[model samples]
Every structure is written in structure tokens, then in C-alpha cells.
Target: MEQDIANFMLRAAKFEFFLVNRDTSLVHTKVVGVFTAIIGVNWTKVAQFVEVAFPFNTFDFTNSGFEIFAQTAPQYLVIKHDGRLGWDCDNEPIDSWDRLLTRSYAQLRNNVAHGNKHQMPAPFTHDRTAQFLPAGLALMNFIANQVFLESDWDTPIFS
Candidate 1:
């Protein structure tokens, strides 16, 4: 039942089974907008539940792309030293791949939504954005599952 609901949310989000037939530059650029909207509307709430302050300002991505955001954004999600997925509070010095991907997504969102809106930097090029699409979908799925499992339903979330 939970899995069904998660699938429903993913479908409702318009990213249940995304595929790129042509993988054009236009598709890549447009996907940044889609990701930004979903994250702003859905995933940001999930992050807030975990006490994470998501970066929504263009200045966060203006100076540098992924590198700057990775350094500045809150490292809430990470792989612990024990190889378990947890928060980055222990100062283990190991970078979480999930965190990195999330940072990249945020940077890409800023680049397209606020910047040139046509071409991005090295790591967030059109091809890389195309490649990150699946990972972005997976991240959204993870956020949805976390919300469903963790929320007690005491208060209604508006956004």
C-alpha cells in the first residue's frame, strides 16, 4: 500500500518513468526547470522536516556550481563511517554520493532557472543533466518515501 502511494505520487509528479528518446539540449535545459519546481514544491518540505535549510537563492549557485553549493549547503544526508545512511554530523570527512547528487541538482536548478537558461557549466552540461535525470527521480522517490514513513499526520503541510 505504501509502495502504491509512492508510485502514485511519482506519477503525479510527472516523473514516474522518464525517458529521453532524443536527449536533446532543449530537454536537458527544460528538465532543470522541472526539477526546481518539484524540489521547491515537494522536496523542500521533506528537507525541512529533517531540519535542512535548502538553498533557493541564486547567490548560492552564482559564484560556483556544484562545488560551492556542496561546501555551503547543509550536509544533512550522508553515509556514516559504519556504512549506514545517516546524517553528516560526525565529521567523518567522507563525502556522501547522495549528498553530492543532491547538491548537483540544486546547482543545476539555479543555473537553468536563474542563470543563462540555455547552457550550464562543466559538470552540469546538457549531457550531464540528461544523465542526472534518473538520479533526480530516485532522489525524489527517496524523499517521498521518507515523508510517508516519518510523518505522524498531526499537522497538515500546505506547501
Candidate 2:
């Protein structure tokens, strides 16, 4: 039983890593798409569309404006909702990890899309480039653990 549990944990860790990488890649692609849309066209016009889509006030181009937009981007909405629901239900909040990962990715996307050349913060800073992999892995582990625990493995593992 002990060996089986150990093996399961090891496999879970590997699977979690894989899931995180995949999720991060997907999020990164979405962020890039949003960034591209913003850059490929007039930012003022794009900002208007973003405002309407998100139903928020216009984002100022100032540093504080970027900071606010970074924190409240729609990409992190599901994570935030999950975190709130988890708290309301008295469950452990795994969504916080997702939010963190999303924030890291969003910041990177924002900087690149906005043409900022400064270095990003630590945990995100890697070899002078932003590194979002760690946060992504953490979020993946949280989600995988939740799913594994809640799932009935006794049933067929696949369809």
C-alpha cells in the first residue's frame, strides 16, 4: 500500500507538471491573442473594445492604469470566481494558485504587448525574461490534486 501510494504521488506530480505546462501554454496563447489584437490595431480603439467586453472603465495608459488592468483582466475571472466560491463553501482555495499563474502570465503579456522594456518582478523574472512556469505548475498541482481526490478512480479510468 505504501509503495502504491508513493508511486501514485510521483505520478501525480509528473501529471500535475504536464497539466500546468499545458494550461499555461493555452493561457499564454490567449493572452498573446489579446495582446496582438491590441497591438495590431489602435490601442485606444482596442481599449474601448476591451472596456466594453469587460464592462469596466477605460484603462489609462499610465503605470497605475496598467497595474489595475493587470490585476483585473478577464482572463483571471474564472479563477477569481472559483476562489470566491471555494471560500463561500468553506473549501480549500485552489483557485488562488490559478489566479497567481494567470496574473504572472497576464503581466508578461501586458509588457510585451505594450512595448515595455523593463524587467519583470521575481518568480516572474528569469534570465532577464519573465518566467511564468512555476506559478503555472503550482496551479496545475492544485487542480490535479483536487480532481484526483474528488474523482472515483474505482470506475474505469477512461471511456
Candidate 3:
């Protein structure tokens, strides 16, 4: 798990590099392949992992202009939706900011993979890549922390 997390971080860095030098569609497609493995199909572990820091009231989605969540087919929805990406959610909408972030990421991956690029969500779009990258990276770090509590993840990679 530790090595896998490290590989994910390295792949994320590569994603940024490609975003800088390649077309947006190409970068999106490339990232989908690796990121999917990291997030996995089931989200129960992610939900349990993030329970350590839920609510996320300190993180303001409105101010950041990222909607709490985005779906491919919101119009077909009603009240009480189940979580995706392997989340065994009850008949309730996603309730936490972290889960919302993962869901948004999953939606983006789906959009790219399933040829639904037109349905890509706000924060996951190429235009907002700079703003969204930090949050995604932080979430990746959170996963790493959950897997190996002994590691000093608090230390900055750069000064």
C-alpha cells in the first residue's frame, strides 16, 4: 500500500507535467487510468478513512466555486441518492466534503472514460486544474496517512 501510494503521487506529478505540455483531453484520459486504481471502485474504505476528518466546514466549497457534488445525470435524480465509486451509501445524498471531492473525481474519470467529456464537472474540468490539484493531492496524502500511520506525512516535500 505504501509503495502504491508513492506511485500514485509520482503519477500525479506526471499528470501535472502532461497538463503543462500536452492537450487537455490527452491528460484527462491518461490520469483516469492511474487515478482509478488509487481511488478504487469501492469507496467504503475511503469513507472510513475520511471519517477521521469529516464535515469539512473549514473547507468552503461555495467560496472555492466548486459545487458540493456533481453527477452525470442529476436531472434523472430525486431525493436520497446512493454514493458511487463502490460507496455502499444508504438512500441519502453524499454528506461530507471529502466524499463529495472523491465523487467529483470519480465523475470526471467516468466522463473521460465513457466518452462523456461534455458532462465533466466544474472543479474537475481542465480550466480549474490549478485550483483543484491541491485538494486532490491532499486527499491522496490522507489515503497514505490512513494506510501507514507511522510515516511523517506532515513534513513538507519542499521548503
| Winner by TM-score | 3
Provide the clashing-pair count of each candidate structure.
0, 0, 0
Model-by-model lDDT, in order?
Answer: 0.35, 0.32, 0.39
Clashes of 2: 0
Ranking by TM-score: 3, 1, 2
Candidate 3 local lDDT, 50-157, one digit each (tens): 455544545444533334342211111113345432212233465564456446544433432333213433333334333333445554454445433423444444
Q: Model 2, 1-159: lDDT tens per residue?
A: 234334434443455344434333222122464363211212233223333433333433233212322343212111244453110111222122233223443333433333222332233222322222233233333333443332322223344
Q: 124, model 3: CA deviation in Å?
A: 11
lDDT of 1 at 5: 35
Pitting candidate 1 against candidate 2, the one with the higher TM-score is 1
RMSD vs true structure, all candidates: 17.2, 17.9, 13.3
lDDT of 1 by residue, 49-90 (tens): 333333333223233323432343322344568885543333
Ten-residue stretch with the least lDDT total in model 1: 17-26
What would the TM-score be for candidate 1 when compared with the true structure? 0.30
